[model samples]
Target: MALASLIMLVPVVLVTSFLSGIFGMAGGLLLLWFLFLVAPASTAIAVHGIIQMVSNGSRAWLSRRYLDLKILAIVSLGLLLAMGCLFAVQYSPNKAIALMVIGLLPLLLWIPASWLTFDASRPSHAFACGLISGALTVMVGSAGPLIDLFFIRTKLDRRVVIATKATIQVVAHFTKVVFYINAALMLDAMGWTTVALCIPAAFLGAWLGKFVLDRMSDLQFRSWTRMIVTCIGFAYFVQGTSAVLSA
Candidate 1:
């Protein structure tokens, strides 16, 4: 990456980070999309995983007071189990179809929360969601919606929701990075330089997002999160459709 290109991405990273800080989910997806536009698929996935690991890590740290350790432990156990299974399975899914599924998933929010019988706060349920999310993230690039599903019905405050989700994603994305070890090797000094430059930008964005988060009522935060997530889903849907049609 040239210095000019790196400079160009600074603002993008800052903006996306701000969004991620505010929503705790959408920014990573959008950033993944941006990286996809500029890098190879394997490289994009690897870099996105790394950057998101940092982004979510910072967010989790910021809201450490609200970290849900129980959920993290349960979900991580399930995630590990799912990852172990992946090592034994040999499969190739249709990438286009997978993206479409990811894109359409957020629409589930339209269903009345009452209609969903699952208890998000339960350990069993959290583990189950993590198991599925771990697998889906390997298939698609990210599983923000699936992660959100695990907390949608919870009565926790917005900041806690963001913080807790951030911790879970840190695990998910770290797994993703290791899974694509070959891709990680593609990061030459320039590539890494770009990533390193973005780290602080990501952190700054999270800090600013904290300011925004502090002002919003929980209801407003939840509403905005759902709306933004739905839009991101549609963006992925369109990108997948275009890719399929072009191919």
Candidate 2:
């Protein structure tokens, strides 16, 4: 990457990390879009995974008191299973397909409460959530909306929701980095340095977001999260569709 492009990405990293720190959803989606503009599909996914792992890791640590270990363990088991399955198939997504999948993911947030009764508090549902969302993360580069489907209806407060989701995302993103390591290796020394610089920016953004998160009510958090994700999803879908048609 050019020096100019790398410089431009610093603020993008900070802002997206802040958003993810708050909602634990849209930031990664937005960051992935930005990355895709500058890198190949696989490389963008790998980079996004590395940055998000840091952002979510910081958020998870900040809210460690609210972490739910049991659910995380069960979900991780399902996630690992999904990863194994994908590895067996050696699945990889092209740019257009990846964009379309990510664009469509936000639709999950719009599903009516009565249509699908998924509660992440339940072991079975949580496992399913992990399996499905983990696969989506690896394949499409982001899965915030899909993960939200399992948690939105649960009785857990915003704190628990954010913390637990962040923790799970840390694991998911780490797996993504491992899966796409080869793509990331395409970057040269400067590219690697650029990525390293984004880490502290991500941590700073998450910390700042935590400050705001403490002041927001649960209702506001949930409502705003849905709205932001829906808007971003619509934009991505349009762009993806255009790309596919043009191709």
Candidate 1: residue 207 Cα off by (Å): 0.8
Please write out the lDDT profile of model 2 over residues 1-247, one tens digit for every residue: 5678888777999999999888887888889999887888889999999999999999999999999998899889888888889988999878887888888888888888988879989999999989998898888888889889889889998899999999999999988898899998898898889899999999999999998899999999888898999999888888888889999
Per-prediction TM-score to the true structure, in the order listed = 0.92, 0.98
Q: Determine which window of 10 residues in candidate 2 has minimal summed lDDT.
A: 1-10
The pairs that clash in candidate 1 are none
244: Cα error in model 1, Å: 1.0
1-247, model 1: which lDDT tens digit per residue? Answer: 4566656676788888888888888898788777766666666777788888888888999999999888888888877777777756843345566557778878876668777745457988989978988887766668887788778668877777888899999999887787776878877887788888888988899888888888998888878888998998898899879888988
Candidate 2 Cα RMSD (Å): 0.9
Q: How close to the true structure is residue 176 of candidate 2, measured as C-alpha lDDT?
A: 87
- Go through the candidates in order and give each one's C-alpha lDDT: 0.80, 0.89
**Best model per lDDT:** 2
Q: Candidate 2: global Cα-lDDT?
A: 0.89
Off by over 4 Å in 2: none
The worst-scoring run of ten residues by lDDT in candidate 1 lies at 90-99
Cα deviation at 176, candidate 1, in Å, is 0.2
